[model samples]
Target: MATVSMSVNGKLVSRDIDPRTLLVDFLREHLRLTGTHVGCDTTQCGCCTVHVDGKAMKSCTLLAIGLEGAQITTIEGLAKGQELHPMQAAFREHHGLQCGFCTPGMIMAAVDMVNRKGNHLDDQTIREELEGNICRCTGYHNIVKAIHSGAEAMGAAK
Candidate 1:
C-alpha cells in the first residue's frame, strides 16, 4: 500500500491505499464521497469529474497516489451547509437534469469553467466546454441555459 495525503473539501485527509487506486474510487470507496459518480470508468464519460487544485478533471483518469498533497473538491464540497452553489441552484431552477446521474459532474465542470473562463460564458463556449460532460437525459438545452444563468449569478455574487 502507498500512503497519500491531500486536502479534500477543505479537510486534510491521509490514507494508505493501493498504488493503482483511482481518484474516483478513493473518494467514493475510501472517503465515502459518493457524490462523484463512476459512470464510465475509462474516462469516456465525465461522470467522474471533480476539481483537482481548482481545475476540472476526470477523476477516473487520475490515480489517487499520484495526487499526493493536491487539493481535491468533489460535488459534496460545492455547497455551504443548506445552501446550494450557484451552478447547482441554477441547475435546479432551470430543470437541467432528468435522471440526475450527470448533474454532479456537470455542476463541477461548470464551476471550474466559470472560474477559468470568467463568468460571462457564451452559449457556444459553454457548449464547447461541456463536450466532455455528457448528459443523455436533458439533451443539453436546459443545461446550457443553466450554465449561462449560473455564470451570470456567479458574476453577480462576486
Candidate 2:
C-alpha cells in the first residue's frame, strides 16, 4: 500500500491506498463521494470525469497514488449548500438528464467545457466538445442546450 494525499472538494484527505487503486474508487469508496460515476472503467464513457487541478479528467484513467497533492473536484463540490452550480442548474432547468446515471459527470464536464470554450459556444461546438461523454437516455439534444445555457450563466457570473 502507498500513502496518498490530496485536496478533494476543498478538503484535505489522506489515505493508505493500494498502488493499483483508481482515482474514481478513491473518491467513491474512500471519500464516499459517489457523485463521480464509473460507467466505463476503460475511460471511454467519461462518467468518471472530475476536475484535477481545475482541468477535466477521467478519474478511472488515473491512479490514486499518482495523484498525491492534487487538487480534485467531484460533482459534490460544485454546489454551495443548497444552491447549485451554474452547470447543474442549467442541466436541471433544461431537463438534460433522464435516468441520471451520467448527470454528475456530464455536469462536471460541462463546467470544464465552459471554462475552456467560454460562453459563446455554438450548438455544433457544444456537440463536438461533449463527444467524450455519452448519455444514452437524453439523445444529447437537451444536453447541448444545457451546456449552452450553463456556459452563458458561468460567463455572467464571471
Candidate 3:
C-alpha cells in the first residue's frame, strides 16, 4: 500500500491505497465523492472528468499515487453551499441534461474550458472543446448553449 496526500475540495486528505488504484476510484470509493462518475473505464468517455491542479483531466486515466500533492476538485466542489457554480447554473437554465448521468462531468469540463479558453466561447469552440465529453441524452445543442452562457457568466464573475 502507498500513502497518498492531497487537497480535495479545499480539504487536505490522506489515505493508504493500493499503488494501482485509479484516481476515480479513490475519489468515489475512498473519499465518497461520487460526483465524479465512471461511465467508461477507458478514457473515451469523459464521465470521470475532474479538475487536477485547476485543469480538467480524466480521473480514470490517472493513478491516485501519482497525484501525491495535487489539488483535486470534483462536481461537489463546484458549488458554495446551495449556490451553484456559474457553469452548473447555466446548464440547469439551458436544460443541458436529461438523464443527468453525464451532467457532473460535463459541468466540470465546461468550467475547465472556460478557464483555459477564456469566457467568450463560441459554439464552434465549445463543440471542439467538448469532443472528449459525451452526452447520450441531450443532442449537445443545449449543452453548447449552456457552456456558452456559462462561459460568459464565469467571465462576468471574474
Candidates in order have lDDT scores of 0.95, 0.93, 0.94
Query: Could you give candidate 2's per-residue lDDT for residues 81-140 as a string of tens digits?
Result: 999998899999999999999888898889998888888899999889888899999999
TM-score of 2: 0.98
Write out the backbone clash pairs for model 2: none
lDDT of 2: 0.93
Question: Global lDDT for candidate 1?
Answer: 0.95
Q: Estimate each model's TM-score.
A: 0.98, 0.98, 0.98
lDDT of 1 by residue, 4-96 (tens): 999999999999999999999999999999999999788877999999999999999999999989999999998899999898999999999
Off by over 4 Å in 2: none
Give candidate 3's TM-score. 0.98
Worst 10 residues of 1 by lDDT: 38-47
